[model samples]
Target: METNEPNDGHAGNPFTQVPIEITISVGRARPLVRELLRLKRDAVLPLDRRVDDPVELYVGDKLIARGELTELEGDATGQLAVRLTEVADLRDGL
Candidate 1:
């Protein structure tokens, strides 16, 4: 009943210090060269997803999870964020 006990055995685990990169793929686009060249400042190349669609998360090239896009307000940094909706299995991640 006391699972809250601390375990120092993993304190030196190298993986705990290692950092991994996660990428989010919203959607893809395929535009002609002429169409691309015609674009100017403030141009919009619409992606292939809706506003409520979840984006795919990837570690390197392999997809690891899916999340919904979210905006952070009143932060002054104008940064965007994601909220995970579905995560891959631990075995698949490994």
Candidate 2:
């Protein structure tokens, strides 16, 4: 076996700088609009999806992951995460 040395040739860690974005999709808007138009001062518009539905996570307009909205130590969080889909790997041939 040969000893390995630290490779200082790389500029930086790619994983460390990976950008991530999270977004929430409430529901459709056509019925919501009609309901809003008929509402009074105090009104509520019920969403089509449940609270435990999966929320989308994207990376630069590409869908990458999904998870449920949750709370962590009193702070809202997304737990039970899952990487549902990913865009084509751009760095494969580069």
Candidate 3:
């Protein structure tokens, strides 16, 4: 889903047009430093997610929502994208 920029003067200066980093978390793993160092090309470190599971969308370290991974349709880059499924409540703080 897309969010429209606030145009009313009520939404002021601090929230400028600057972009924020958005990270998609496929899953997590706890690999030791030794194990990580041993990893080289094609060494698959399997994440805690299955192929069909929904991934998390995070801003900074907070989980603001979740989404499903999808292919970028009609894009030559063949890049991946996410379609948001759910948005977390700000008061609940994830």
**Model 3 ranges off by over 4 Å:** 1-16, 90-94
On residues 1-94, what C-alpha lDDT tens digit does candidate 2 reach at each position?
3337465554456874576565545354456566767988776666667766766665566655466655553343544334343344445521
**Which parts of model 1 are misplaced by more than 4 Å?**
1-11, 73-78, 92-94
Error of 1 at 9 (Å): 8.7
Clashes of each: 0, 0, 0
lDDT comparing candidate 2 with the true structure: 0.55
Q: What C-alpha lDDT values do all the predictions have?
A: 0.84, 0.55, 0.85
lDDT of 3 by residue, 1-94 (tens): 4349655563657756578999999989889999999999989898889988999988998889999988886744578889999999865565
Relative to the true structure, candidate 1 reaches a TM of 0.74
Candidate 2 segments whose C-alpha is farther than 4 A from its true place: 1-21, 32-34, 59-61, 74-94
TM for every model, in the order presented, reads 0.74, 0.45, 0.73
- 1-94 per-residue lDDT for model 1 (tens digits): 4447486566657886689898889998788999999999999998899888999999888878899988877854567798999988856455
Predictions: Cα RMSD each: 4.2, 6.9, 4.8
Worst 10 residues of 3 by lDDT: 1-10
